[model samples]
Target: MKRLTAAAGSNLPVGPYSQAVISGNLVFTAGQIPVIPGQHIQPETFEQQVRQTLRNLETVLQAAGSDFDHVVKVNGYLTDPAQLEPYNRVYAEMLGHAPPARTTVCVSLWGVALEIECIAEVIDHRLRV
Candidate 1:
């Protein structure tokens, strides 16, 4: 097992935890919030927050040798049920078609609209040649 820190300029973990972990062929990412790396401000809109969160997730995934196409599971948390529609739209737009199995629920978050985490299969780029 290997632990990863902030990847591809993604935000550093707020607590004592790695951003992602790799074991064998799989990469497990910690939940990502909408805060931009090196910036404390978060996007004001739910849709914008969702997009930023996915961008952070993508950064960690790519660093772990994976991408959205390789994701197999996702767990999402939203502070409001009303944000679901916009969240879905942004999710589809960012994660692409045929998204992985996911579970999203309304929950209380500290000054954030949503959070997302994913499990993905790691790709060995050398094999592509």
Candidate 2:
């Protein structure tokens, strides 16, 4: 069975999609943008947006009974390729050793600077009945 999961305190979905969905041991998260709830604003700097996006991703993973440590793959989109260095710096710092396989690309985004999505392995103990 598949289950939809939403992170507590996270912003409501930007569209008709759940923050994450769990199927068996795998958790798939929808692309996370840097919009913070209540504020309705994305951070000013590219680095700040990257960090907020990662933090938002963390919330989705936790809601799915997983975390960055268990992420198996990551997909990131940046509006400009020039932002890659700063994005990498924050990503490396947050993921630390043994970071998951990642694919990042430059794409035109609407309003936001970047977006991030990931796949993670849900711990067996966290399976819901």
Candidate 3:
């Protein structure tokens, strides 16, 4: 059975989609932008936007019983090509040593600077040997 999840303390999805969906052991998250819930303070730089976007992704992952360490793939989209370098820096720091396989590209994203999405393994820690 498939399960849909919406992080309790995160921004509600502006569209019709749920924040994430879980099918069996996999959790697939919708694209996460830099809109922090209840906070109107927008990021002033690409790096800050990257941080907020990743945090949003984290919320979805946690709600799905996963985390960055369990992520298997990532797809990132930037509004400008120049944002890639700074984005990577923050991404590396957030994901640490076992970063997931990723593909990033520049695209027109309306007013947002960037977005990130991922697929993760939904591991139940207590069941692990």
Candidate 4:
């Protein structure tokens, strides 16, 4: 198993935890919030926050040798049920047509509107012969 930090363009973890972990062919990412990388400031609008959070998730996935197409599962947390429609719109736009299995629920968050975490299969090109 290997632990990873946020990639170059992603925000550092706020607490004592790895941004992602690799085990064999799979990579699991920690929940990502909308705080700007290196700036620690979150975007004001919900859509902006969702996009930022997805960017952070993508950074971590790339660092783990994976991408959205390789993701197998996703867990999302939203502060309110009313945000679901907008969240789905942004999610569909970013994740493309064939998204992974997902579970999203209303929950309380610190200061952000939503958080996302995912599990993905790693693509180790070096192993190809």
TM-score of each: 0.93, 0.93, 0.91, 0.93
Per-residue lDDT for 1-129 in model 2, tens only?
456646787878867788888877899999999987568899888899889999999987887789888999999999987999999999999996779999999999888999999999997555632
Off by over 4 Å in 2: none
> Candidate 3 on 1-129: residue-level lDDT in tens?
355546887888887888888877888899999987778555887788889989989988887788999999999999888887888899999986897899999899878989899999988643222
Model 3 residue 97 CA deviation in Å: 1.2
Candidate 4 residues 1-129, lDDT tens each? 888865677887779999998888899999999988888898888999999999989999998888998999999999999999989999999986779999999999988899999999999764212
At residue 98, candidate 4 shows an lDDT of: 71
**Candidate 2 TM-score, C-alpha based:** 0.93
lDDT at position 3, candidate 3? 51
Per-candidate total of colliding backbone pairs: 0, 0, 0, 0
**Candidate with better TM-score, 2 vs 3:** 2
* Candidate 2 displacement at residue 9 in angstroms: 1.2
Clashing pairs for model 4 are: none
Model 1 alpha-carbon drift over 4 Å, by segment: 125-129
**Candidate 1 residue lDDT tens string, 1-129:** 888877868887889999998888888999999998888889887788899999989999988889999999999999988899999899989775878999999999988889999999889553221
- Candidate 2 has its poorest 10 consecutive residues by lDDT at 120-129
Compared to the true structure, candidate 1 yields what TM-score? 0.93
lDDT of each: 0.88, 0.86, 0.84, 0.89
Whole-model lDDT, model 3: 0.84
